[model samples]
Target: MDLPVQQFRSEVEQGMLDSFAALQEALPGAQNEKVAKLRAKAIERYGSLGLPHRRIEAWKYTDLRNRLGEAFPMVRPSGGPIEQSEIEKALGPRIANMDAYRVVIAEGEFRSELSDVQALKKAGAELRSLAETLEHLPDDLEPLLAETGEQRSGFEAARPTGRSGAGPDPIIALNMALMSGGAVLRLGDGISLDKPVHVIHLDGSGEPVGSVTRLIVITGKGASLNLIESYAGLGGRGLQRNALTQLVAGADSHIEHTKIQREEDEAFHLSNWLLTLHENVRYDGFQYTNGGDLARNDVRVFFEGEGAVMNFSAASMLKDRQHSDTTMVVEHLVPHCTSRELYKAVLDDESRGVFQAKVIVARDAQKTDGKQMGQALLLSEGAEFDTKPELEIFADDVVCGHGATSGQIDDDLLFYLEARGIPEPQARALLVQAFVGEALEQIDHEPLRDALTGVTADWLGVKLD
Candidate 1:
């Protein structure tokens, strides 16, 4: 007689354990000995650590253990390439009109037929599918895939405390075991992408299915590029999405990036972005959300050299018991670097919003300048907002500050708008837009900014002629 398998405490854990066994046996990467070992290590670490919960300070507000109930197995491509009609139905009205070089990921597979890979290559950029690369990973991939810290950045050692695998994040660990395909964009030295590259993820399989999509973007010295990502779930039940984006800015490069999410009302969306910047680099990034029952965005940034600058911003519109969390960590390891972050949210009904940020300055990282702020507008008495801002400084010469605030809509502003012939609903919409627009304006790209503005209009029910 065989002993029975141990039971987990919750449905989510049991599902994860069940899915890991299935993915390890069926996924293509299992055939490769090196990749197989990596996957096994990741799963083992995840098992030991379990789901990030309120007990951990970093994940305190967004309790994955209590909230998630899906086992969300890895998706495999069963049908043919996604058709144009399907893409249209999935993306909705706002992102469809944007002029961008589109890359499509459907049913956990990269759809080359629907992508503009050829145009990107012609413009001196390199693109590849992660699944293809996994079959024959290059030896030099380690340097491109190094951990996220510098010589003096706090927590310079490898992550997960003491895990051995392709990465430290538990979600990324599960992804390593079952990820089907993703996108990779690399720009060589002095190469500049003229048009923005847009990555679109469509989840509309009409059933409960979850998949991991990974995107790696690297810019060589003196290079410049703009990248955008959109995640949408349509006509589906029990849809879960996990995405990981890795960004490396080479010396003297400029990178502008933004992420927009508009998934199904009951879908589960989780994303993580790891960014590393070198000497004299400038990074501008943003995130805007309009959908999801449970959504969390985690971002981490590390400065590798001097004279680097970063401007990070995010905004969310939530209602009807929705939960949205934005978590970020910034590490300064070099001298003369500056980073600024602003987050805003508008909550209605009984929705909840969370903003958690931590900035660490090392003893050797002198002359570092960092500031962070979180602000939220409560549109209803039942809405809830939580914020945590922290700064850890070991250097005597660095300057860092953080602040957070949540309050109801201003009466004076509402009255002023209604007095100017604007109806009560319209006046509320205008005020909400103005409140979130402060952070949206940080993105310098005009067209992208305007496109996001259009999304805000839709959220506010504003009519655009």
Candidate 2:
């Protein structure tokens, strides 16, 4: 006799499927046939793949299926009342007063009253809410919503232990299936912004809730922009956030993208950055993560044209029982392109950190240069870190390499600092700051870098001189 096979589904996974079924008719872009089909396809794919787990190679280190116990109710657009002071408090000290064009998303909905729409419009930038854009349904929105099959196949092929039946990334699929409110920014050809455009995401709901947001940015040829994204919670617990941002850089365009994630201690955060670079484009990206109970950052970069340059850096600080994972994949599909990645993590208490990166160079991508490095600092004996760096080069004339390292604070250096006038705590803080400063220094913007440095200092509980 053969026993019947049964597939186990977690509470969170079943809740997500039920929520989608209940909210499908009321979701954004429900009236559009294209978006409807996209959402259907995404949910179907998600049902088959389920939540990513340790069984999946890419998600081996960070298992969402086991970590997320229950799925909170999906957040709706409430247009709730929120004060600018509350926003500042959520952003913390130094970054709250930065000078930039601000866009605020509270409780997963775009808050027009808090955004600097007029200023952005005056600066030759087109801004729209994802909900509004979906309602209107632009002709070019299909490509923005759907991930190409070729890209997924290429990623699977590049993996050492390829996924047998993985169709689309489950995280991305879930985000697309339930995406509601976010901002979309577009810049015209040759247009340049004098100030950065800051997008702030705040979770203010008192009870448990889940939010799905999507941001789309497109830059025209010769255009330049500096974009910053900030995520924080306003005294909320049990918050689940899944956010996706897609950026397309035109030929010869210069784009600087920075992200800071500092959610509440009880929150679960998942974020993805999908970047496409064209010919002669310069793209600089940085991420600072120091919050959330469990957080994962997934980034994928595609070089669609030759002569493109990309630099990506990240810094993560975790303490207590917090867990953070940063995964990146950079593909060079064209010749004469360059890519660099650097990530740093600081773990204290019983916290755990993970870093996984893979760089792939296509067969015809001659003269490609790619390098990746991940470093971790453990402050306590219980702290743990795992790092994996991989390089796949099919081109003969390519220079590609990867490295990873994890260690505790150097005792000699700490003792040397203590021998000076500095106390032990201050000396340790300084060392931690310097350890992460290498990754933070990649940001070219002074104010942004300084503000992020202040954040890092705050995380270390020391005031910077």
Candidate 3:
């Protein structure tokens, strides 16, 4: 007798199938041959692999196949054109007060009125809507549109994500299939952007919509740029923010990237960064998460040339059943490259936090230095934290090390703080703040660090001096 078998197709799988069909049929880029080809390949690849679960090693800590449900279709542009008043109201005073050129993506569409596109173009920066640029497939933007790195099953799962690494990423393919609106940014050779570029994604409409925003960033040799991005998930049930950022730093170029996530507790946020560094390039990046029911940030970096240096850090303060995951993969493909990774997580109530970091050094990558550390502080009995740090070295001259630690708040420190005339809650908050502040301090920008610290204080129910 034959036994009944269980099916693995979830609502997200089925919904994605329908969503791809809808995008192909109704989206504006339906007629663009390049977009059509990319979308078709993505759809076919996604159909082949499906969603990933804990069975995959890299995603073992945070299982999307089991936890992810309810996938929404491509979000159409809804509501009237956004006025300056609405943009101000959505960005709030903190982001608005920053000295930067703001590029706004509201409801999955690029809002030219709210952005400083013209000013950027006038200043010799190449700024174009991703959807618009893809229409013509300009020669300069060809590198970003093409795929890079080893074959993968999905993301860093199944295997790793470097030369001779893991399987393909379906989420990547999915974004390429239905990505709606984003920006392509390029800095003129030998020029530095006088002001930082603030790309803020704001979703205010209460619709079951998923925004697939893709950004392609290219910095010419000897140029520099400071990029700040955030996801403000303001409204809706089951709101999803799926974003993909591909950045390339030319030789002798510098890039400082900062990200902050302060979404509503009911929203879902997923972000992926694929960045590469050329010879003598410098990259400094940091991320902080305070809100969102389910938040995952995946970053992959490759040092393709010699003399590249990178410092990446992140902090997560989760509370009230919130779940946050930070996964990072760094590959040293050349010689004389150095990378530093630091992550901190504070879990309160029933919240859960995950941090997975891996570093790889190729056989010929001599003088490579890579280090990573992850520390988690659990504030409640029900809170849980998982951390995995790995280092794969093929070069005998390479130096690489990793460490992970998870534990509850220190009673001794709590007592000492309480003895100093602070209340228990306030003392605990102070300790947690200090724990995460260490990671946040690595961010180069002072005001941005302060703004993120303010969010941390808000989560801890304490004020920062």
lDDT, candidates in the order shown: 0.80, 0.88, 0.80
lDDT string for model 2 (1-465, tens) is: 122222777888989989999999999899988899999988876776688888778788888989999999998657768887888889986787789999998888988888998889999999988988888877876887987222532545444322422235778889889998898999999999998999999887578899999999999999999999999988967889999999999999999999999999999999989899999999999999999999999898989989999999999999999999998878899999999999999999999999988887888899999999999999999999999898877789998888889998899999999999889989999999999999989999999999999888888998768
TM for every model, in the order presented, reads 0.93, 0.96, 0.92
In model 3, what is the error at residue 70, expressed in angstroms? 2.3
Where does model 3 exceed 4 Å of error? 1-8, 83-92, 148-165
In angstroms, the error of model 3 at 100 is: 0.9
- Tens-digit lDDT track of model 1 for 1-465: 122233455778768768878767666556777777777766675675566677666677788888887676667676575666666677655566578888887776788888898998999998888777767876655444333222235353554441311124666656665566787888999998887898988776566777777788889999998898888865757767778888989999999999988888878888888898999999999999878889989888888889999999999999899999998878887889999999999999999999988888878889999999999999999999999998878899988999999999899999998998988888888888889999899888788888788778887786633
Q: What are the runs in model 2 whose C-alpha is more than 4 Å off?
A: 1-7, 148-167
Question: What is candidate 3's lDDT per residue for 60-108, written digit by digit as tens?
Answer: 7767777777787667776466665555555555665788888888777
Which regions of candidate 1 fall more than 4 Å away from where they truly are? 1-9, 143-167
